[model samples]
Target chain A: MSEWALEVEQLAKKFPGVQALRGVDLTIPRGVTVGLLGPNGSGKSTLMRILAGVQRPSAGEVRVLGRRPGRETKERVAYVPEVEHLYPWMDVDEALRFTAAVFLDFNPDRAEEMLALAGLDREARIGDLSKGYRARLKLVLAMARDAELVLLDEPLSGIDLISREKVLDGFLRGHRPGETTVVITTHLVREVEPLLDRVAFLKEGRVVLDGEAEALRAKRGCSIEDLYREVFA
Target chain B: MTWDFDRNRPIYLQIGEEICRRIVRGDLPPGARTPSVRELAAELRVNPNTVQRAYQELERNGVLFARRGQGSFVREDPALVGRLRQQIAAAAARRYWTEVAALGMSPEEARRLIAGVIHDDKSSLR
Candidate 1:
């Protein structure tokens, strides 16, 4: 309970021309569901990508489970990018086989359970599923791992109401207490507020608000959705 | 079992009071197990943490007791129902007084208004 699951200190990232991150600091304890809140292009994805080791930070430090966010952390962390990057030609079973071959912690049983829960057929090709189902399938793949941390970027976006609720339920059902840390980045604050333990409000490459969900709600006397509008408006 | 609470008050506290009231009214009889946190949260469309807090408070207040690996059940204290009824009555009086004062009604006028409303409500129900 006392262990620090992930930590970032003065983290910064630079693209070809834009500075996406500017000295951001965040600390997440184990077993917490953190909501990474921000508008589009507010460095939420860049921060997540950097922590996933898909992109290196231009400066500063990041530690996942007390190790650098590289091979060591990569083995223990599961990341779901916002975009559908899975090969359209690959079937669901083939994708899981490839993913299981890559991540040591990948649980085939858990993956199959999540797939079944998400109602995605293993025989169907990725290109055949609807965009919403495709996103859900990718999410299920990421969540099936017994990783220390799971980074999800906009897992609720682009889905109908009924499907969105089902997907959210699958995410929670896949996680066990003290076994996984989930960082969900989304603009749909109201939909995801209940699952959040801590919330970080990012605005223009900076985290302007970061704290426990209840404390933030008490301070503003408003829901997280209203707080976002007040801060970003 | 059905309520739409105002967000102005803390949700957990309201849930705790509502549960106690249910117990006092025999809606949840003594020894009856309370709903699981997930069940109540899903039913209320509220955070599970909020429901957990309410259940914790209920246990602490001696209104409920948890059996390990089983579930929380309404406490069988002999005096609990009477005690809770008094507390609810006191709370209602406090709210009524405060509201009447805010509306600029004198004590006598407030009392008369309360009597009139209760009488009208009873007659209408009959």
Candidate 2:
């Protein structure tokens, strides 16, 4: 088994007109919570998609759990996209059932616990649920799986403070350090700063800064949010 | 207990100082089991790694001891506890003196003000 949960070497992605990732290289060790931080158009979501095996990188290599990203890697890696992907007609319970049916490692009891933690109603229809509740439901679905690597893309985006707290609490509840590695991407640095063990700052499809979160804070004498502003500004 | 972390310093150091304060204040009595890193992290809403760093620092300082398969506990030495209390007091005094000096107060005047505050019945320590 490899020491790293994720490894991306000279990874690049090209769209029809834009080069999303430009030879980006990153390595995340197992059992650490890493914040994948960057502004929009910085290729955070594209890197996540590539790691999740939903999209292929145009050049270079990507690995999850020491294996190249494939069906096997997908089994151990759970990816929560930035947009809502659940069927709108289905209720929360149906969504939970669908997730359980898809992921063999999905724990129904744990899912229920997470739903309660997030204050989500199991019987509420997905379409009728508010944005916050929908976000919570999505988190519940992603975290219910006992995957080795969990990638969360913009989990707190567009949610109110109270809802964000609920989702964060749920995420923490489901997290098992030294057993599972979590990679969360978000532009809201201050709120998630306390939760990150490491951070990788991206800019224009390239890694600008990456290091242990507390070490960076100690060296810079500032919060990660301030560091982000300085790096991007 | 609630932790208010300052953004100016690293959080693990703050966590370590907070735990030390609790120990010196007797809130976490000698021989009492310290909360596990995960429990404290969840309560503080901080990363578990940060909490682990704090625990490791405390252990290195002889404030806490860990047993195999069991959780950490406060050191049972009363002498060590007394020394820890004195250390905390000295740190607090140094910080107070520095701030008073920064305010341009002379040593004698700062002493008089501290004495007055200590003896004043109108003020609450809290």
Candidate 3:
């Protein structure tokens, strides 16, 4: 196994009229949590989809868990897409069962733990659950897996305050140190700032700044929130 | 139970100082087991790695010690805690003075405020 969980060099992605990613290079060490931070349309989703092996990069080299992003890499990567697509008709328990049936890496014990942490009820249907609970459930599904790389795309976009707290709480509890590498994409920098070991500020399809979170704070003499503002806004 | 933080400083450093504050104040007595990084991180709503880094720093400073498989514990040395207490106080005093100065208080007014606090003027302290 390689120490690097993800390696990308000159990665590029073009979506018809829009060039979503433009020669972005990024490297993530195994077992580390990184924040891919930027406003919407900065190519955060494009890069994440490529890493998850759902979308291919047009140019440059990319690897997930030291392997090219493809079927094998997809097995190792747990992707919580920005727009989640779990069966809306299924109840919470059924959803967990479906996940277990699909992914060999799904851990029932971890699923139970995350369900309790997120305060989700097993009897409630996915459609009946509020947007916040649904968001939490999506995270639970991914975190329950023993995947080497977890990609969370905008998990905190439109949730209310208390719900957001529970979601953040789940993030704190669910991560397995030295086992899972998480890459979270969000514009809500301050909320996730403390959770990140590393952060890369993306802007207009390029990496504007990236480094160790704490080291960046010490060097820049400001929080990542402040830097995010200075970088993109 | 998230701890309050100053956004300008490093989070790990702030966390380390909070633990130090607890130790120096006897809230965490000598040899008392500190909360595991996972536990504290969850309580504080920060990353486990940040809490881990804080613990590592305290261990490096001899304020905390690791016991192989067990978690970190406050050192059993009275002098170590005493030194940290002083360090924390000095840092707080520096911060207090800087804040007062930033409020455009002259040295004489600042001295008067300090005197009022020393003389137990609770209202003035506020």
Best by TM-score: 3
Error of 1 at A110 (Å): 4.4
How far out, in Å, is residue A156 in model 1?
1.2
Provide the overall lDDT of each model, using Cα atoms, as 2-decimal numbers. 0.84, 0.90, 0.90
> Which residue runs of candidate 3 sit more than 4 Å off their true CA positions?
B102-108, B122-126
For every model in order, the fraction of real contacts preserved is 0.08, 0.65, 0.78
The docking quality of candidate 3, as DockQ, is 0.79
Model 3, A1-233: lDDT tens digits are: 78899889999999889999999988989998999999988999999989988898889999789899898888778999989689899999999999898899998898899999899999999999999999999989989898888999999999888788888888777898778999999988888898899999899899989999989999999999999989877
As for TM-score, the candidate ahead, 2 or 3, is 3
Going through the candidates in order, their DockQ values are 0.29, 0.74, 0.79
Better of 1 and 2 by DockQ: 2
Best prediction by DockQ: 3
DockQ of 2: 0.74
Cα distance off (Å), candidate 2, residue B21 = 1.9
The regions of model 1 sitting more than 4 angstroms off are A107-113, B1-11, B14-18, B21-27, B41-50, B81-126
Model 2: per-residue lDDT, tens digit, A152-190?
A: 999999989889988888888888877889999999998
User: Of all true interface contacts, what fraction is found in model 1?
Assistant: 0.08
Docking class of 2: medium
